[model samples]
Target: MADFETILERGGALILPTETVYGLFASALNEEAVKGVYQLKRRPLDKALNLNVASLEDILAFSKNQPPYLEKLYQTFLPGPLTLILEANQAVPSWVNSGMASVGFRIPSHPLTLDLIRKCGPLIGPSANLSGQASGLHFDQIQADFKGQVDGFKDDDFLTGQDSTILDLSTSKARILRQGAISKEELVSALPQLIFQD
Candidate 1:
C-alpha cells in the first residue's frame, strides 16, 4: 500500500477510484484539502461533495441517525455503487455540507480506494474531472485534467466509468435523487415493498 498518510499529511488531493467513477480525493475534515478539491474542480460551494468511508463504522460516525430503512439499505447496497444522503453530524465541515446540514456518504466498492481510505480515513470526493467536463473513463483521460492538482492517480483498472446511484435516506421515506450506474430496476428489486418517492 502507498503511504496514504503522506498524501494526507501533504494536504494534496488524490485521484481515487470508486465504483461509480474515479474521484478527486481530499480529507473530509481538512478545510484546506477540501478547498483544494473545490478549486481543482471549479465546483460551487452549494454543491458540497460526497464523503466516502472505508467501512460501516466510518459511515455511522458521520450520520446523525441510523434509521431502520437506512440500516436496510446499508445491508443491501453498501460496499457497492450507492451513495446514501443523510443528515450530517458535527464531524463534517460546513464546506462539505454546502451549509445544508446534511451530507452524502458511501463506502465505495473499488479496491485501491478502499485500501487507501482504510489508511487515510474518510474522504471527501467528487468525480475526477474538471467541473462541467465529461466523467473520465481512463487514466490518460484523467491525467491532463488532474495533472498536479492531486497527490496520486489510480487508473481505470480500478475505477468504473459511470457514477453511482444516489439515494436520499435522510427523510422518513426513501427517495432516488440520481439514477446512474445502479439501475432503478435493481434498487426496486432490492427493496420491493418500499415506494421510491421523488
Candidate 2:
C-alpha cells in the first residue's frame, strides 16, 4: 500500500475507492479534518458521516449494545456491501457521529481501499462528490470535483458503483434503510432470526 496514512495523519482528506462509490476519506479522530470534509462537500453539520473501518473488532470497539445477530451479518454480507447502524460508544467522537447516539459504520469490500484503511485506522468516508451531487462512479469523476483539495487519490474503475445496503440495527427493531448491492431478501435469507422492515 501507498502510505496514504501520511496525509490522513496530517488531518488532510483523500479520495479513495469503495465497493460502491469513490469516497472522501479523513481520520474520524481528527475534528478539524472532519470539519474540512464537511467544508469541501458543502455538507451541513446536522447530517452525520459514516465511518469506514477495517474489521468487526473496530465496530465492536466503538459501539455499544450491539444487536444479537451482529456477527451473523458480519460473517454474511459485511466486507461486501452493507452498512450497519449501531449505537455509538464514548470512543466515537461527536465530530464524527454528529452528537448522534447512533452512527453508521461500513467495512468496505474493495481490497485496495480496505488495505489503506487498515494502515491508516478509522476514517469518515462519505461519497467523494460535493453534497447534492450523484455518487462518484470512477476515480477521475470524483477527482475532477475535488481537484487540489484532496491530499491523496486512489482509483478503481471496477467498483459496482451502487451504494451499499443500509440496515439500521441500532434500535429494538431492525429495519432496512436503503438497498443497494445487497438486497433485502438476501439479508433476510442470511439471518432469519429478526424481522427486517422494508
> Which candidate tops lDDT?
2
- Top-scoring candidate (TM-score): 2
Cα deviation in Å at residue 118, candidate 1? 1.7
List the lowest-lDDT window of 10 residues for candidate 1. 153-162
Relative to the true structure, candidate 1 reaches a TM of 0.90
Per-candidate TM equals 0.90, 0.95
lDDT of each: 0.78, 0.87
Predicted structure 2: lDDT? 0.87
lDDT string for model 2 (39-156, tens) is: 9999999899888999999999999999888898898877977999999999998998889999999999888889978988799999898899988786776767888888888777
Tell me the spans in candidate 2 whose CA falls farther than 4 Å from its real position: none
Tens-digit per-residue lDDT, 1-198, candidate 1: 346568876777888778777888888878888898899988887887888887777778888876655666677878888888888888887888787867898788777788878888678878888889887567787887767656776666755576788888777777778877778788778777556665
Candidate 1 scores a C-alpha RMSD against the true structure in Å of: 2.1
Candidate 2's TM-score: 0.95
